[model samples]
Target: MRHHVILRVIAKLGIPFIVLFALYVQFHGDFGPGGGFQAGVIFGAAFILYALIFGLDNALKVAPMNLVITFIAVGLLVFAGVGVARQVSRLRRARRQFRRRTASRHPARRARSRDHGRRGHDRDLLHLRGPGPVAVEFLIGHYNYWIFIFLMMLGFYVVVARGNLVKKIIGLNIFQASVFLLYISIGKVLGGTAPIIIDGGGPVTYSNPLPHVLILTAIVVGVATTALGLSLVIRINEAYGTIEEDEINDMDQEP
Candidate 1:
C-alpha cells in the first residue's frame, strides 16, 4: 500500500485508542512508571499524525499551538511550582520554630542564643556529606526532583520566550531530558553494582534497574518526539514562510 493510504488507515483505525491509551498511561503513572511526559507526547503524536494526513491547519484547529503551548507550560509549572512551594513552606516553618523558641524562654538573650544554636544544628542536618555511597545516593535522589523542577522552568522559559523554531524544540528536548534525569536518579542505589554480571566470584549489590530501563525507553521516545516536532516546525515554516510563532499568529490573523 502507498504510505499516505496506510497513514489514512492508521489514522482511522488507531488514533482514538492511541489517545485513550495515552491517557491511561498518564494517570497510571503514579502507580507504575509512565506519567504525564510520556502521555503528552503520545497524545501530541496522535494529533501530529492527523496533521500529517489531513493538513496542519485542520490539526491546529483541533489543537491550536496556543493550547499546546499552554499544556506544556502548565505541566512544567505544576512540577516546579510544587518544589518552590515546598521550599517556601519549609522556610516558614523554620521561622515559626525560631519565634516559638524565643517566646517560650523568660530571658530573651539566652533564648536567642539557644534558637541560634538550634538553627545551626538544623543547617547541619540539611548539609549532606559524601564518603558513604548510601548517603550520596540519598542526597542525589532527594535533590533530583528539585533539579527536574529547575530544568522544567528553564525549558518553559526558552519555549515561551524564544522566536526560533529549532530553539523551541531544543527547549522541549531539555524539558523531557530533565524528567529522564529524575527517573534515573531515583533508581540509583548506594553501593549498587552495574547491571552486567562479573566473571569472578565477587559480591554485588544491584540497583532497582527498573528506572534505568524505563528511562531508556523514555529517551528513545523523546528522540522520536523531538524529530517529529522539528519536522512539523519545518513544514510550518515552509507553508507560512516563517517559523517565529508571533509571525505565524499575525499571518493567520491577516484578512
Candidate 2:
C-alpha cells in the first residue's frame, strides 16, 4: 500500500538489485551461461515483485497496459519476422547455388558436389547414422533429460487440468522452464567448459553454444508470452471478477 512504509522501504532497497541481477544474467550469459530469456524472466519477475508489494494499481501506472501490449506486438514481429525473413533469403540463396551446381557437366565435379551436398545437409539432430540403439548407461548418464521430461509433463498437466487461472499460469511457466532445461541439457557436455576463449588455455573442450543461442531467442519469446498471459488474467479479473476458468464460463453461459 502507499502507506506501507516497511514494504516501500524494502522494495526501494531490493528492487534495484533484482533488476541488476537480471541484467547480469542476460548479458553475462554470452560468456558463461546467461541469455535473453533468462534475462527477460528476471526483468519480469522484478515487476511482479513490485506489483506484489506496491500494489497492482501502482504497477499498472508504472507499466501501462497499452505500452506492454505495444511492446509485445513489436517484439513478436521483430523476432518472428526476422526469423522468417532470414529463412526465406537463405533458402533462395541455397536454391541459386544449387542451380549453379546442377549447370555443371563434369562427372568428377558432379560426384564431388553430391558428396558435398550430403555433408552440408548433415546436422546434429538429423544424421545419416541414427542415434543408433540407445544404451541404458547412456540414458542414465544424462539424468537431466529425465528431470526435464518430468517437469514438462507436470507443467502440461496443471495447465490443461486446472481451473484456476493463476495456477494455470504457474503451470505454463513451469512448462516453459522445463523446455529451457531441456535446451540447456543438450548444450551441456559431459566434461566440457564454457565456450569461452582463454589467453593461454590450450585444447579446451567446451559445451555446444548453439543451444544457448537458441535458448536466448526462446527466452525472449517466453517473456512476451508470459506478459501477454498476465495481461489477459488482469482483464479477466476485471470482466468476470474472478479468474477461475469454470466461473468465467458459467458467467458467460448465464442470461
What are the TM-scores, per candidate, against the unseen true structure? 0.44, 0.60
Q: lDDT of candidate 2? A: 0.78
Q: Count backbone overlaps in model 2.
A: 2
What is the C-alpha lDDT profile of model 2 across 150-237, one tens digit per residue? 9999999999999999889889989998999988876665587766656576655566666777787787688778879998999999
Candidate 1: the clashing residue pairs are: none
Model 2 error, position 234 (Å): 1.5
Query: Given candidate 1, what's the lDDT at residue 231?
Result: 93
lDDT of 2 at 217: 74
Position 146, candidate 2: lDDT: 77
| 20: Cα error in model 1, Å | 42
Off by over 4 Å in 2: 1-4, 14-51, 56-139
Which candidate number maximizes TM-score?
A: 2
- In each prediction, how many residue pairs overlap at the backbone (N, C-alpha, C within less than 3 A)? 0, 2
